[model samples]
Target: MQTSVTFKNIDPSDHLKSYVQDKLNRFDRFLDNPAEASVVLSVEKFRHIAEVNITGDRLKINGREETNDMYSAIDMVMDKLEKQIKKNKEKIRERRGSRGAVKASPMVGFADTLAEEDAEGEIVVTTIDYKPMDAEEAVMQLDLIDDSFLVFTNAKTDEVNVVYRRNDGHYGLIQPIR
Candidate 1:
């Protein structure tokens, strides 16, 4: 896991950064390869705010917490992130158990619905918000929806790509030949 911490309205402290890193390290047991965490710690007049975004294992989870103490805020946010990770993992496990019934996580593109198919299997076009993100982000986006595939712009390549859930509980990517 890679972690980056930003401090706002507060002095940068090794102690604080280490604190956040230690807390996030515990999540390694729950995430797979290429996990990245972006943490922002800020202080207001009376509120210490922590914002965390974790991307890994085809999942993107964000948690924010505010408290009177910085440590408290970090703890609260970490707890929230943990719950989200567990809930998402549980949902995926359940879906995997009945793989045939739901082979793919939905083609989730910012919550847009998939195109409808006619009874005769005619194709229909559906418009979605295309965002530039990596393949892992695309897969994570797909995991949250009910569609089988997602079309997105690859942030690295700056080209359109398709990511779909496979029947074997994995993911497939389709890219254009340039």
Candidate 2:
């Protein structure tokens, strides 16, 4: 897998870089294409923070941890990522029994919801064409742009899906059931 390490508010060292790369390489066995992994190491006051993002095929997993030592933070983050991948694998296995079976449509209803508080001056609106693509490509486009979230139609199911960057420096996918 292609790995890139970035250090913020800390001096870049070959030793630290190699350490992170070595730790992230353990996830290679879980991925098919492996794609690329981005690791960010930063220091906040007394805490050492490590964040890892790996995107491959239809999977995008991210994990972050803060500890007194950078190496320990990296280890914790990798452990969290492993747990997420295992959980996702289990979910897929559970659904294998329903393979090729058409599922019933879910009921939909709308309830009155409060509007979001806008603190940034007046309302601003922008429009863009909705394109159909897979979740992986949608995330790649989000990273390439300045937006925090992207909405696109899923190429496989033709359903609307959203890919957004989370506060913990990870990506979140939202798929609406119809």
Candidate that scores best on TM-score: 1
How far is 66's C-alpha from truth in model 2 (Å)?
0.7
Taken over the whole model, the C-alpha lDDT of each candidate is 0.85, 0.76
- Model 2 segments beyond 4 Å from truth? 100-178
TM-score of each: 0.56, 0.53
Error of 1 at 3 (Å): 0.3
Candidate 1 ranges with C-alpha deviation above 4 Å: 100-178
* Candidate 2 residue-wise lDDT, 80-160, digit = tens: 988987787556644652462432112111112344455678554444455788888777666544367777789999998
Residue pairs in candidate 2 whose N, alpha carbon or C atoms collide under 3 angstroms: none
In terms of lDDT, model 1 sits at 0.85
In model 1, the worst 10-residue window by lDDT is 101-110
lDDT for residue 44 in candidate 2, whole number 0-100: 91
Check candidate 1 and list the clashing pairs. 106-145, 106-146, 106-147, 107-147
